[model samples]
Target: MNADRAETVAILALGWLASNDELGPVFLGSTGASAEDMRRGATDPAFLASVLEFLTMDDAWVTAFCDATGVGYDEPLRARYTLPGAEQVHWT
Candidate 1:
């Protein structure tokens, strides 16, 4: 996934999160992000990637996000690879 695509997915996921009565507050509290921050972050690729990364942390969240956004379950994996500093660390 390219940065643009990943950012789009993240934005969509953020919208879903924000609309959920339970998860909305949890997401904001966990990330310490205000509504203002989310508005600002929507335009920031790195911030968007972080939002996706946060959602990918849990399988239930990933499933719910995917179902809500009409994306495949594997999208989060692809999005993670597109983010900055996502290079594999080969320690052999």
Candidate 2:
């Protein structure tokens, strides 16, 4: 039961950043090695931990985003996007 509407988180994140016009180049990864680096970083909880270390979002924001789009924060950072209660069986 991978989230019915996956990719929603990333799209919203990017869209929100774009809307703010503050999407610094520093927050993004290029398509080749940078992309690879991001993916790699995602898997290293410590790395992802560092990447998200500064976020100051409220749970309300996450809830609102999910409510607004009917999705979960299941976007694949480095991990497979699994639905709220699923076993994450698809990507293996």
Candidate 3:
């Protein structure tokens, strides 16, 4: 995905997380982000990447998110790779 499309997916993921009663608080707790932080972070590529990162942690979460958003299950990970802070580390 291109950066623009990746960002759009990340924003969708954020909305999904925000509306999930069960997982919304978990996300906030996991990321240490307050509501205000979320509002501020919406435009940050790194933060959006984190949202995708969090979303892809569980197969069920990814499945549910994809189902809800009508996107492919792999799209989140793909989008993550296209976003900032997602560069692969080369240790060779």
Candidate 4:
């Protein structure tokens, strides 16, 4: 992953962690279950695609959501949504 993608992934991981437990979103207004959703998303492309789709709409949460769901990364969990994409955010 490039710097931008890597950064995006880091923030997302934070957001994903925030989704867990009674904590306020990893970033804010976090929709609980990013972690669970990611877990389900993994080994389940359909679910992953759904999550990516869900994120595309939520500009504010994309970062935290990704942070909370750091499935394809190697970083310690810190409850805080981090992914915040620019206007050019998109999924494939």
For every candidate, C-alpha RMSD to the true structure in Å: 1.7, 9.3, 0.8, 9.7
Question: For model 1, how does the per-residue alpha-carbon lDDT over 1-92 read when each residue is reduced to its tens digit?
Answer: 77778777878887888788988788799889998888888888777777887888899999988988798899886887787656789999
Screening candidate 1 with a backbone cut-off below 3 angstroms (N, C-alpha, C), the clashing residue pairs are none
Comparison by lDDT, 3 against 4, better one: 3
* Tens digits of per-residue lDDT for model 4, 1-92: 24344344444543454354543343234444545555554444333333444444454444445454644323212111222232255686
Ranking by lDDT: 3, 1, 4, 2
Question: Any runs in candidate 3 off by more than 4 Å, and if so which?
Answer: none
In terms of TM-score, how similar is model 1 to the real structure?
Answer: 0.87
What is the number of backbone collisions in each predicted candidate, taken in the order shown? 0, 0, 0, 26
lDDT values of the candidates? 0.82, 0.38, 0.93, 0.40
Q: Where does candidate 4 have its weakest 10-residue lDDT segment?
A: 75-84
Clashes of 3: 0
- Per-residue CA lDDT of model 2 for 1-92, tens digit only, reads 32322333444443443333333243553222244555555344333433322121445444544455554454333222231322446866
When 1 and 4 are scored with lDDT, the better candidate is 1
- CA shift of 78, model 3, Å: 0.2
| Candidate numbers, best TM-score first, in rank order | 3, 1, 4, 2
